[model samples]
Target: MFKRILSALSGKKSRTSTPVSSVHADASPPSDESELITVYDSYGREMKITRNEWRDNVLLPNLQQKWSDADELYSLIISGLNDGFVADLIPAAAQLVAIDSNPERSHVIQGIVLLENGQLDAAETTLRAGMAKVGATGTLLTNLAKVFTERGEQALADETLWRAVQTEPNLENGMLWWAAIQRERAGEEGYLQALRTVAALPGSWRAQLWRARHYLEHNDVEPARALYAEVLAGGRFDGGALMMISGDLGNNGQIPLIIELIGPVYDEHKHDAMAGINLLRAYQELGNADEGQALLARLYALGFMPIKSQLDQFAQVFEQMRKQDVQGVPIDPESLKFTTLALNQPIWHYGLRNADWFFAQKPEGASQVGFFAFSKSTDGAEHAESQREDELGRLSRAIPLYLAEAVHYWSDHVGTCYIQIVEGGGPVLSGAEADGQALFDIVPPMMKYFVTGEIGCSGEDDQVQWQIALSLWDCATRTKSATESGSAVKADLGALVLDLETRLLAGVGLGREAPLDSFYLRPTAEVLPVYLTELGQSFMLTLLANGHVPKSSMWGERAMLDWPLNMALHWPTLEVAKLMYICGLGKALDYQSDVLAEYKERSLQMLRELEQARSPALRLAPLVWKVFGMQAELHAYIRELPADTSPEHKAWLDRVSES
Candidate 1:
């Protein structure tokens, strides 16, 4: 019956008259006489009456008519209409006009209708007008802003939203929406503020989590960690939060803390790949390599690929140890033995400098002082023990320790070695003759090996000369082989040596050119032939061509021997080659010019390769014979060339011919 009435009111059904009007003649009169009405008898049969009969005979005559109020009339009319009926009855213009008086309510209804009808402009206009009249308060402004935003007017929408927030400060909805808008506009800070406001609202876990992330992004680790812990303590075990905190702690080098924090999380959720991976890294960084390896095995059992980068990093720490003899310093048996035997190595041997120096150069926050000593098999165990005790043992050892005294004397004054000897022996050894003899014995063998690859003990002065010769040899060899190696090797060596030289020279008050070449070069050269042969011509040539050889030599010599001038001369030829390649010709040159310029370039290149070859059979004759034409120009100032040759041409010819 209700369906029939609704269909009839909507004009989908034809109406029939009912006898109830005749039975109840005291009822209200019909508003429209021609309108159809359907009446059903209790027996389910329809009864009909003529319009005139219904209006005059039964409806109109019995009705008590009164003047109609417009508001009441409008209400009655609107009540009778469905959404579709109202839309069909009222024109858009009439609706817009009706909105002026009760804009909020009118626009709300109209906006919905317009939006439904795909009339975005009409909807926006209606919503904005309604909002303007209502002072941007309550749901009206929020709805208006939403419509504007939906239509892609974000700025306008945001403006309206802020107004809405201000209009109803106590309303959480407006504030939350406004906060969201701010977040979208402004990035992390905006989001953080917005999320904070959101979190103040009851039961906003998602908001709180985002706020924590904002703290983490800014490196406020303590707060981030605290927040995450708070969340977890509150029984919020989010996987993402756990992962983030773990990674943060690991990156900050808080390896042990990271493991402790994430251990439970990992155990509870063994299936989590990220947790497993991070756990592995944390263990490795904390020096719990065994534990880290075990975790990796566990991850493998759980069907995960082993993280290669973390594995490599762990391997590197150990590999670096193997390359250097002791835990910290380079591999030197004497230094190691002395360090081991000394109860307090820093005080006894003077090798460990002041705490200030160590602290300044310390790795990150490393605080502990430790040492490792090595005893060579050739240095008889008893002799090694005696030397260690003499140099590093407590002051009560009774035996005079010369090396310990020398180290102590050298540590105090930069150039005290020479001065002390001149002053008739300082603290280490007494008497000029004894001091000179000790210096000669201690320094000469190293010097002789460097100069000529032979240990010559002719005399004290002879040792000094031998040492100088070795220094020259090292510089020559370093320069000669500079063009053969790759740039990375050369650069690494250079940086290393430069740092060493700076330290050594600074310690001794000696210039870089001081003739300590024999001390450094002889040992270096002895190992160089084997080193170069091991690194074949190809590697050597690549290193030299890239100007790495000189850099390596400089670093090695400076750090090991403190030989400045010798280190400076190591890669002159290679540097010259590089200069020529960079300045004289580029790829733009013609093939003929490039070939002509290739001689000096090729010669330097071949020299590098030759250093690498094990035998002459491995050498390329073409590379050996190739001469660099431009390099000969280096000799131009030494001798005059033909009168026909221009200065530039002569310079170029001289550089090539000189080499």
Candidate 2:
């Protein structure tokens, strides 16, 4: 079946007839008058020989023509000479030498006999001497060049042709050979120039074809297509040329016409992978998913398996999109989220635990997802370390190494940052204080300098000066070991936190201020929620005094404000409500109630509209209308919470329920 398909696609036809033999039986001899053999001498004169006299005189006397024909002696000699019958032709050569009217012809005949006898050197010398006597012209020069070319003296052969061309520039065959030689030496431009000159001559399809090939080689597809169209219009269906034009069109993104041009070739060569793969890509890009899938399945059947990593990557993208949909958000097409998802499946913990973090942001500039598999080997470990070092080095060399390090270290505590090192181990090593200190000791001097802020690595002149402030904080925090008393460590961490706050207020723009608030708020809220509770009270009083919280404080306040909303009902204090109202959660909760009511009314309106919709397509409208009903149900759930209830606490509960 496959072979049948392939044959159909390739356009091969069945052979029809047996070839006829040139040899014939029962051939009669020529009459005596017509049996005379005329030989053209080198001087443009002719000589004639009769059958009997030539054989008796030439054959018997020289001992080399014993095989001469009895009935047609001269005709047999001519045939024998042409077929290179050496023994029979030897006496003819001697006879020719005896007839000394044309010495150049005698020498040429002797050279042909020597060439037939495999004496190339003798043949070449004889031919050269004969050519000198004959006064070498186009015919003689061309013959000698052929000999030299066959002997692998291409330069000499080319020089001989050049001489021929100088004598007769209009020699069509000589011009073609010169063009081919020039093409071989100087490439496409030289070849095209020569080919164009040849093409301008009368009746030159070969030159036109050569010109078309030159265009195709340089990716001049439009001109190549024009040339190919001309050839096809002239009723020449060159299968190879057609295939080339189809591929050129496909490569240049002419998706629609690619199939039309190459369809015949595909039909001819069904198993051709290039044709199949390209067809698949074209269909896929056109959004013909069913056709694409069928083609891909066919390719699989033909023993081509898509890489497993690619499959996994596409799955991840789908999963990220699914998660983003639930968060009532649109995924940024340009974000790394889309890029990562498009490439592969999201990581296990992504969307499962860290979905909120992804959802909270606009999904812009998120890191692209990728996969890496581990193996137990020293080489693999080294490779992994080298890759990590290279990434770190780029960050260190371009920016501040300390700032980069601080961001990474801080993210480990608050975000889903993790490093899954596949160590072949008896016991696992942790990245706790002791390990960090040991690792710090072994780190390179430049890294250590940045970590400790000992060198004050900062300046407009310094390449990594942007990292100075973060480096200062990292140094202060690292000074207090994790193994030290909690109070001591807390004191150091608190001081650094205060310093960072002051720097942030000073508007350094060290990093994106909006997103970094979570990092700042997480540690402070988790480690010292009590302090934040008091801080929230003071901030609310300050906002009340000013009549509004500043725009810069809005995101930061929201980060801390969530805790008070959840605790509001339990606390019932003015401070809790004030923080909630200031951060906009109080307003959000009231807005949710109103939206739920509106959704309920909209659901009823959609039902009425559905009944009025008479067509089948309109009947499907009710299905979309059910989404409003769902929103109403959600709103009711929110409204049932007590007025004094912390909106943050309710939100957390809803989040857990949704999960």
Candidate 3:
């Protein structure tokens, strides 16, 4: 049944899941996908995920079809760029670059590929060279400005974007880009005037969104909502207007506001696939599968078919949930004692097989990323001189170190492009044209991707359209640690993580570089689950690191660190395993009588911390509704818990019941 749904989207039978590298091609095509020998190139071999595997690995409903020409192919490629067809996009992008009939798109797409491949300079050159040839068109300059921002060249980005706006005053995108810079640099007061200019422009969907967002940011509810109302009613501009306005709250991880604003619309617009898709993904991001699925069922019943690719994207998300819901893998019931020799030195790779911090040496130094099973190692004695510098402190610092490297890695690869269907498939999202012109060139919200995780991709950026990378550790840590002495709290950790990310993003020079839903800020709706999984992992990790199990807050304990150790529970990769360990831990403790007692409050506290702290992980989702859903499930479990519920917890549950 699933395969049939997927086949309907891609118009191709699901192929065998074998790596193309492992198979040798025969002279003739085989009878079926099984018989056919799939070829893997050098890149494919390196990724270990062949186009076939990436295609069939469960990114929803397989949405690829052979195109007659590269132009048509390019259009579809743009569509797939964010839709989990990234690996597939490589060859397609290359195809477009090779066939340079329209050199303009060729340059842009090639630049995108170059950016993806970590060639920032080459991408800049490609875009600049194109601009010299074609003049500073909004599309070229908008793209070029993105590279500049990724390179951390704010001056250049601002200048180029200014040029883009002047070069094409009518191009709302140029104006939007210009406005984003002004907002970031000058704040709302300085940004508003420019936005007004853009908003006043004829058929400026994005400009209007900026104006609406300006209002939203200032806590001016009526104008913001009114602006959204006006623009959404005007027509379906490629950019989802409501998202541009309300969704902008992602910068602050404003899950509640997003829910409040969109929830009613979601309730009212059940038949509007576009609105429903965003709402569903938002719910999923919030980690509320019940509501998301409820909406999904309604959408599916409505026969919402926008495009094959989007259907495939949605299918991939559902398939993942189905596996978890139906044929789920059983986690080991026994708690695993974590034992490791904590090395004090800065580590990136190598050393011990059991070591938490594994640093792989690069030619110059070492790989930026150092994959680890746990946060700060338990090297120091359990009772350190300062109690504050317990396992949580070390783990917190260690985590930033590891993740900052990823940000640095990502920073170098700014202006990265790939299709992720943010808005679900809906008649190919043919948004209404402004000024009787189709802004096929302007992809509404911006483009960003993350280091892929099994459940969903999570990156450090705070905003949906604007991506933040954790780059330049020394700068971020030094700057932040100096601000606050001694131990860095998780919020400080967020700052350290985000500053470097911001730097890494602006880092091209500091260094360099560097879901969904039309619901488009997310690439595709499927990523909602990934965000939920990531956010859940974060909340659990925070909660457990503080205390959980027989011995809570046993960070430095050698005999029994009863807390959740990084999961050996494989989710395709060890990184994801470590990342989502808390969720697994939560599941394990749920069975224990002692742990079940405070589970409701504990989980609720974790959720509250997510909001109070404004966690970076919270930004992973469009919303954290899943946190509430988890609480709901915990409440159900609380009811099932054998007697001996504490008065406080009982009171809380009573309060919940009353509500």
In candidate 2, residue 603 scores what lDDT? 30
In model 2, which runs have C-alpha deviations exceeding 4 angstroms? 1-150, 153-180, 184-188, 197-221, 250-257, 264-266, 269-659
- Write candidate 1's Cα lDDT for 458-536 as tens digits: 2233132111001111221222111111111321322332333233334223133422211122113222322222112
Query: Given candidate 1, what's the lDDT at residue 219?
Result: 70
Model 2 Cα lDDT, one tens digit per residue, 1-659: 00011111122121111111111111333435235554322111234655544445443443343223221223333444432244446556555545545555555555555555556677667667767777765544654565677678989988997676555444445666788788888886787787776656544444565566566667776776676556556643333444444555566666665555444345322334555556655654554544554444343333221221232233334333433443222323233111001101111111121223222232333331111111121211221121111111222221221123233223211111112222111011111112333434543332212121111222233242222222221222344221101111322433443444344223222334343323223233233323334333323323322323223222222223233333432343322232232223222222232222222332333234335543222222222233333555445555676788655545543553343
| C-alpha positional error of residue 77 in candidate 3 after TM-score superposition, expressed in Å | 4.8
TM-scores for all candidates: the values are: 0.24, 0.21, 0.31
Q: Give the winner by lDDT.
A: 3
lDDT of 3 by residue, 507-545 (tens): 333242221001112112322223223432332333333
The Cα local distance difference test for each model comes to 0.35, 0.37, 0.40
| lDDT score for residue 142 of model 2 | 52
